[model samples]
Target: MVSSSSTPAAFVTGAANGIGEAVVARFLAGGYRVAMVDLDADRLRAAREKADPAGERTIEAVADVTDEQSVRAAISATVEAFGRLDAAHNNAGITSSGPNTHELELSAWQRTLDVDLTGVWLCMKHQLPVMLEQGSGAIVNTASIAGHIGYRNAAAYAAAKHGVVGLTKTAAIEYAPQGIRVNAVSPGPVQSDMLEASFERRGAAVRDWYYASSPTGRFASLEDIAHAVHWLASAEASFITGHCLSVDGGWIAQ
Candidate 1:
């Protein structure tokens, strides 16, 4: 059930920056036709241009994963552009903080779930049908350290990511018979623009703590998380499915 085409294609959400952006480059380097989706049209276009200045093998999709119609259209566009859909990365998500579950606002909770958990579902909702039709495909969801364990103030984000982990496993099981593999990548601490801003807000002390906590003594580079994701979609990981691969540099072990 491997792709017959010499060059396969991939659809990646949250592709404007961070790990998503890194994955876009990774797939391109692997000789893939990539459709990069992000909510930020400008940033996404910039990424698309930087990734493929010649306007070949890359499509910029400005779509929101949280909206069902938007998600469907984006997938459709990807297929139209690439002639087939072989892989997907449900990587778009938002971070939300609540003092605690009790104090968490209903709206905040709902939005977090909508973007992080339900968004992945929607992407699968649309992408699975295409993969099912093609009879083969792969998908990777970006879960987090919060999904595997507790992070005190991030109840809402944790809940949503945990849901993503469950969803990934469910899809993997259901689609195994049809040659589709669904998996997740959970990262503990990564180097991204978001982390920089978060640390700036949380102060140097907290930032330093995250670095020292990593057994490797530093935050994960964007490529660290991206490479794991790229592997899951490649032939090397053909036997791996429904698995939550932890690229946490031993943070999970601690």
Candidate 2:
């Protein structure tokens, strides 16, 4: 049996809820110390309370993933708390609302790239050195089904996620020789708060159509994505790098 104390330390962003929160919980259960970062202070507190009832191996921070200073500080805090950074899940992101390619607002498009694509770049900029110094680490980035296929009124999101996949592959190649692994996870329609908000913005019928179209006959659960992330970040995936693992319930396959 693997001992909890022997598990490597991990840092996760967007960890206040949904898949991020579930990943934190799962990693903790597996005996790893984790640093959780989120933009929502109250939600972050709640997640900390629930995941680290004893506060023995978890640290929670409120930081904006899109801000360089904030992300840098959060990474610093993680190192401070955990003594070393062994793994990271850069999972914070936002969606675009019906921003079609032809009519997408420039500001909206820029914001999507800033948070989704550039944010991952910034996190990696700060995280890679820590891993390089240690000569071993793994990083899993959150992409989306949009990353692989173009969906109507989601041009900004698709473009940004594509950028994430591109970046992951590049970094994976650049640092693979240095004992670092970089990969990405693209999820389909999961029942997350992000989806709920999208439904409110796009209407129930459209959201229902998304759910109905999944080959799995239903949307993915948070745990489904969490489990995939766990494997990608574990020793089992040491040979996997520069790859985009899809946990989309065959959404893209079909």
Candidate 3:
């Protein structure tokens, strides 16, 4: 329930596909200006074509979330395009290198941490200044259910996501006094390209095993996660911070 006068601009990373794309669409539909950032230029363009046909207030930036220079430039571009940044969804991240933690290469582990954990830090590093200047803002980070619990072969991903939740909580408290809120959204198995790729690699039986374990007997949808993020960034959540909102279809309840 953000005030109409403060319908602020938003920046969303990893917006080329899946949940990121859905978040962009939801924000745009709510009449908020948005800047979408992704490493894949072609995919970003396609997402724009599908989500922001009018192109009235949508800005697209091709950048790597792991690269500080790219991220800084993208944030700068967002501010230049929209005048100010009032909200951000730091959703850009990569999966673990492989299924087996012990066998995973150091490079792979490092890459996951770089994108999933450090990337959020970099976004916050730049975003905080803008938000502080405005004296009001909200940030919703994309963590995973793995953040709270371990998965069999996803040690690196789980560790990195756990870091995200910790960072979100600390930042939330540090900035709450300044009228800035930071929160994390932990999604369970969601029906996204990420999950589809994992299914293709691991087979339907394995994927079905996960779905069956969920209390809801199903995976969450992109829109399901998007709705949660939208709520976290809205003014209705003004009193909420240092919170990890789970949109995991009862996966954690079990």
Candidate 4:
């Protein structure tokens, strides 16, 4: 085991980069042993190394959230390493390409749901069991402002995120009596490679539109979203459950 039973341990998916990476840092900084999971094995190791150069407080789990067996094994591995699971951030997801509903292929829709919606469920399927066995745990899933509102060209992405919100609420209720709390963080435009790529593909006009829509007039940094995830999974938010906190820089308020 990596640490004493008194030390908290956390599992985070999509942890190789972006928001997930930042969340791992937050957890580690808070003195939690962390399992950094991602599909990209190399990046995951590098991330773990960067966050814990002494290799004392973190482990890297290469996992595909869409694969049940992979997710199960990763969770098991984390428990084996850390001795217990106290929190989980189911953050592995991908955004759909901007294709109108009429232009979107069926495969694209299925792919988005597989990674964004079904993936979250699979992680929780395995994670919840561990948390239940431990008698307490916190889970924070990554949602989006799009989950709360319809986006013009992202039908599948929006639908999948909407499903995430529903799942968060239902799971929170079902698991609350078991001493587990489930919630979600809905981020708007966050500064990351993914958003930058979208801007590259769509040009300045779309980017300007995003800026204008946000009351902050700017995108959120990865740390902004990470902070929300960390707080939602912490003891500070003990009374909050079945809630979807928006870290959107005031985008949805408009």
Best by lDDT: 4
In Å, residue 139's CA in model 4 sits off its true spot by: 0.2
Full-model lDDT for every candidate = 0.91, 0.90, 0.90, 0.93
Q: Which ten residues in a row have the lowest lDDT in candidate 3?
A: 1-10
RMSD (CA, Å), each prediction = 1.9, 3.0, 2.7, 1.6
Question: lDDT of model 3 at residue 71?
Answer: 91
Give candidate 2's total backbone clashes.
0
lDDT, candidate 3, at 157: 94
1 or 3, greater by lDDT? 1
What candidate 4 gets wrong by more than 4 Å, as runs, is: 1-4
* Candidate 2: regions farther than 4 A off: 1-7
Candidate 3 shows a clash count of 0
Prediction 3 TM-score vs. true:
0.96
Order by lDDT, highest first: 4, 1, 3, 2
Encode model 2's per-residue lDDT on 86-205: one tens digit a residue: 889999999887855889878999999999999899999999988887788999999988898987888889989999999999999999999999999999988989889989988989
Tens-place lDDT per residue, model 1, 44-124, is 999999999999889998999889999999988888777788889999988776377799988999999999999999999
Model 1: runs farther than 4 Å from truth?
A: 1-5
TM-scores of the candidates in the order shown: 0.96, 0.96, 0.96, 0.97
What tens-digit string does per-residue lDDT give for candidate 4 at 145-246?
A: 989998889999999999999999999999999999999999999999989988899899998888888898788998999889889989999999999999
